[model samples]
Each structure stands twice: as C-alpha cells, then as structure tokens.
Target: MPVIRVEMFKGRTVDQKRQLVKELTDAFIRTCGGTPESVQIVITDVAKEDWGGAGILMSDKYPDKK
Candidate 1:
C-alpha cells in the first residue's frame, strides 16, 4: 500500500480536490502498480491564518491583506 499526503492552503473547490486525489491515486497506481483501494490519499487544507512568517499570517502576508 502507498500513502500520499498533500498539504496546501485552503480555498480550493470540491472539483479541484477531487482531481488532485484522482491524479495522485492514478500516479501511484501507474508507477507503484497499486490499486486505488491500496492507495491512501490524505489532503490537509491548512488555513492561511494557521501559517505564519515573521509574525504575520499567510493571510496577512500579502498586498491583498486578508
């Protein structure tokens, strides 16, 4: 079995997440010859506020200034 974890900032559509999971699973199946049932995909969507750099949240780290 192969486990693939994807971590990224939040705000993606359901379709986008679905595509990502499908493609990742497909890759594992193609290269590792693993079945979809044997492949585990975990997607973690971290909020921008949970990420920080230099005392600023990623939500605050730009000109848009969320």
Candidate 2:
C-alpha cells in the first residue's frame, strides 16, 4: 500500500478534496503499479493562524484576504 500525506492551509471545498484524492490515487496507481483501493491518503488542514511563513503567520500575512 502506498500512503500519501498532504498538508495545506484550510478552506478547500469537499468537491475539490474529492477530486484531489481521486487524481492522486489514479496517478499513484499508474506510476507505482498498485490498485486504487490499496492507496491511502491523509489530508491535514492547518488554519492560517496556525501556520507561518517568512517569520510571519499566514493570517497576518494575508490580512486583506476576502
């Protein structure tokens, strides 16, 4: 089994996540010779305030975000 972990800032819709998993599974199977069912994916969502970059929090970095 191939295990994939994806970490990103939160806010994607369910449909987007569904598509991401499907495409990832397909790619993995095609490249690694494994069944889709044998692939495992874990998505971790981090809040803007909880993640930082360039010595600044994402929430603060993008304070003007809509």
Candidate 3:
C-alpha cells in the first residue's frame, strides 16, 4: 500500500482540497499501478502560525491569517 501525506497552509476550500487529493491519488495510481483501495491519501492542513519560514510565521507573510 502507498501512503501519501500532503501538508499545506490551512483555509483552502473543500473543493480545492478534494481535487488535490484526487489528482495526486490518480498520479500515484498511474505511476505505481495500484488500485484506489491500495493507495492511501492523507492531507494535513496546518495553520500558518504553526508553520514557520525564514524566521517568520507563515501566517505573517500570507493573508490567510485570521
């Protein structure tokens, strides 16, 4: 089985996330020749504050902060 983990800044619309998962899963299936049941898609959405970059919180750089 293949387990894929995708991490990104939170606040994406549900549609976007779903599409991303679907596309990625499809890619894996195509390359690795696996069935949907054999491939696992895991998405971990992190708050900008939880992710730091270049000595600054990602939230500070992105307008996604709330």
Best prediction by TM-score: 2
For each candidate, C-alpha RMSD in Å? 2.3, 1.3, 1.8
Better of 1 and 2 by TM-score: 2
Which digits, one per residue and each the tens of the lDDT, describe model 1 over residues 1-66?
A: 778889888889999999999999888888889579998988999988788888788877753444
Candidate 2, 4: how far from true, in Å? Answer: 0.5
TM-score of each: 0.77, 0.88, 0.84
Candidates in order have lDDT scores of: 0.85, 0.91, 0.86
Best by lDDT: 2
Model 2, range 1-66, lDDT digits (tens) per residue?
789999988889999999999999999989888798999999999888998999999999876466
Kindly report which residue pairs in candidate 2 clash with one another. Answer: none
lDDT score for candidate 2 against the true structure:
0.91
Better of 1 and 3 by lDDT: 3
lDDT of 2 at 7: 94
Off by over 4 Å in 3: none
